[model samples]
Target: MAWYATGTVAVTNGSNVVTGTGTQFITNIKSGDIFIALDNGLLYEVDQIVSATQLTLKREYAGVTNASAVYEIVPTTSNLKTLAQQVTDLIAIYQEIPQSATDAQDAAAAAQGYRDTAKTYQDNAAASASTASGAATTAQGYRDTAKTYQDNAAASASAAATSKSGADTAKSGADSAKAAADASAALAGNWAAQASGTVDGANYSAKYYAMQAAASAASIALPVPITSGGTGATTAAAARTALGVPAIASSNTFSASQTISYSQPLFSINDTSGTGVAVLQFNSNGSMVWQLQKTSASDLNVRRYVSGAFVDVPLSVSNSTGVATLAQRPMFGTATPWDSANLPSVSGRLLNIQVFTSSGTYTPTAGTTKVIVKSVGGGGAGGSTAATSAGQSAVGAGGSSAGYAEVLLTAGFSGVTVTVGAGGTPGAAGANSGNAGGTTSFGTIISCPGGSGGAGGNPSAAAAVNPSAGVVAPTISSGTIINALAGQPAPNALVLVPGSVAISGYGGSGPLGVGGQGRQTTGAGIVGAGYGVGGAGATTSASGAAQIGGAGRQGVLIVYEFA
Candidate 1:
């Protein structure tokens, strides 16, 4: 076969395996066949036929790896010869005939010379025999010499016959080789001619048709016909005309309503000066009635077309800020009560509010442009009252409230770290001071310090005991404060009627929470009621018992996000 190229193949660089797709290697190819890769025009000898779609090459693929590559498999023979090789062999065989013929001629000449020498020796022996009886020995010697010459001649003639036979056999072999070479040439020519079939008229071969197709593609006419899925006209105007569509600037009016929809922006205006305006107008009988205009500043304005001129409607919306201006207030429908809950939210209105009681990262809601942050530090714990003996009394001071701060943050805001302060631990019994509250912060933008703990009360043996001092309010540390306020100080312990009628101080209150009440009898202090509030102090009377202070309330961070 010329070549088996039924399907494509795949090969990897530096690999000996060849994988075929839709190929019939087992049925159409075999070992020792020539494999050619059309991708790189590289040739390889098939080493083994693994399967119908697989084979092995004698050598590894040396070119770039390719998949679904065109290839060919040409059948081969063990002793295949080319035209040059056949001619060379024929010449060699013919050369052998000449050499053999020359050898035969030389042998025949040697034999004739030996025959003449033998005849001369026979004549000399006859002469010697007739001369004398003593010459008889000499004649016999001559005869023996003639006999040796004759034997030599016979041997030479036999050699000539063998040489002649070899020459004839060599000639016949040469003739046969010539005939085989000529037949091979004729067969090759036939195959070549068949591949290059006549290209005249409709009887063109594959190659001829391929060439014609390439030429035609190279010279295709511009502006393909509409039947071929293209506009028949070259220019846009002509094309629109041919499609029976009106031009964008045409004055033709549509008899029926038409809708144009597109996935992308319908159109864009590229204004280099940043001052271009677009307008849409409603007309009746060639006279404009109303018009909507996009101004050079990107603001929208409504206008009424009066007699020979357009008048502004006193209504315009800013595109950059989304702020609207109106000359008159808008009237609301009585059907829906315009309460705070029912009011429609305008642009830049509050979208959501988040309150955090624990430390966490705060992510703004989508489209939030600004956030209002309000933070309060934790409240301080109350002081404990000292234990007293019988007929003695004690009272403790109340804790101070936390600081409060607020800020408005806008621009370049992302994930903000929020930290909520925990409440302070209560003071232990036996005249111990209360623990200070923790600090609250909103990222690095704002921070509020917690309140200080209250002082412990001293045991008094006398009927009149001095009251303990109250706690001070906390301070603000960081932020561009929109509003900041210090917390309220705790109340001092009261000593009415000495040990028997003493009362503990009450805790301080904050913006978000209420303070705890003081104890009047022999008991422990009460805890804070809500966030950012101070705890109440403890008190003891006739019982002379020790009392512990209450814990402070935790701080809070509130975020009001707006667009």
Candidate 2:
């Protein structure tokens, strides 16, 4: 019945209810179940089983606020383990038998010794009888021979007397030996009987105690089934098997938990042999891979599988748990362009000014040589839309840039002029190309022509005026040349163009809408293109008044010196 569940925390910060989204993990939980927050390692007991999705906690549910984190459900007490524990205790406490049976064995051994001693005595008695018989025969021979001597002399009579005395002595010794042998045989028989009676009908007292113990051991009933728990006899038998030197059985364990280990790998060569061998490998999940093997008598190589290969892991006092873990982030590679231009090989001073005016002085620091000048003519103003017609909007051309120029000086030049360019002005009602822009100069060192003005917009199918071209770019000494940005084509009235500027530095194109009568004064405006930039063009259908076009913007001159 002992079990555990894994679930995620679904809600937090509630004092009474702890909710979980996991179906199985939260469904079976009852009152008194324990709840744990994995992140903060907080433990709480369930006070009430509120519902399948919720539980009443002993206290406020507080810990990891993240509902997605995990918690473990462990049973406090259950029947599955009880039978095993009870059986184990029985095996330990009542495993021995009584020792009084050893006394019977000692008595039997004593009787055997007595029987052997009696056999020796009987052999001695038989030898004594044979000696007596021989002596009697010798006496008879002496008497017969003496009768023949009596006829010859008195010496025969004396020999017969000596022989008679010897015969009497031999008979007395034979009788004594026979008596001693009989007594020894009788004593041997008594000892043999005593040895045979040592157990005396096999004492039933031991059997009684043994039967009682067996019944007690067998009567146990477990609330749940277990491989190691059953009807008493089966359970006891299983428990007894634990006494054996268990066969290890692959990874099966005998005790509650055991520390497992292996000899560190011996370095003969690279070993790729998998588990049980001292080599690293990836598991089915590509995780939990490591090994320790002996190298020398004392050296161990700890290794792990990494990136589809095996590599050594660091081993020291810290490796007591026999685990080596690794963590890392993803990786990448890249490349960039390489050049000397824009690459700062040497340091220099370059001053920049971009304003709405024209013609300014440029003073280079003492060692100035080459000067790169970039110029942009002002933008032209937009053309104004018609009044009392459709609501029309017009766009203007952006200012043109003279592009760039790198001028080489005759060395140690004192200074040159500086110029800032202007942007185009906005157009108003009734105006077309507002005004022409002023030209800009860099004090003879360089000069920029002004941008052209835009023409007025007309609903009468007339083409709007195009902006004028900027100055022909200044010529430079060497290495770098001058180029001008392109100009925009003239815009027709009622047009649409998004971001119609730049790649050529042109301004936005006009939107397609017109205005009412001139007196109404609400028409779309066009921009002009000069040094202060061209003014914007304007349009109005006012009575008897003509709408004006935008003015062009002013030009600019820029100077740069490098050391």
Top of the candidates by TM-score: 1
Which parts of model 2 are misplaced by more than 4 Å? 1-358, 389-413, 419-432, 459-479, 486-490, 494-556
Best by lDDT: 1
Put down candidate 2 lDDT per residue, 1-563, tens digits, no spaces. 23344556564554556676654544466656656665433456667766566677788764324667566654432111111122233224322322222333343343334444444444545554555455555555555554443443334334444445555677756555555545555555555454334333223333444454444334322211223332112232232233322222222222232222336522233334422334322243545455444443333454555654666554411224533232211111343222223223334433222232445556664445555555544444444443323333333333222222324444433445555545444345443343333444455554444344445444322223334333334333333444433233232232332112111113321110011111123233433211233333443432223454443444445344454
Angstrom error at residue 252, model 1: 39
Residue 256's lDDT in candidate 1: 44
Task: Residues 1-563, candidate 1: write the lDDT tens digits.
Answer: 35799888998877999999999888778777777776533457799889999999999885557888888875654322211222223223221111222333443444444445444544555444344343444444555555555555555556555555665778866555555555555555554444333222223333354454445443333454455444555565655555554544433444444443345424343456779987656667778876667889988776677763776565667799866665334333445322333332434655556778899999987667887787888888888888887777888777777887777777544687889988877777978877877888887777777766766777876644334334433344443467776767887777676657888877777766666788889888777655777777888886577888878888888886776
lDDT for position 311 in model 2: 61
Runs in model 1 deviating more than 4 A are: 1-345, 463-480
Q: Poorest 10 consecutive residues of model 2 by lDDT?
A: 510-519
Q: What local lDDT score does residue 428 receive in model 1, on the 0 to 100 scale?
A: 79
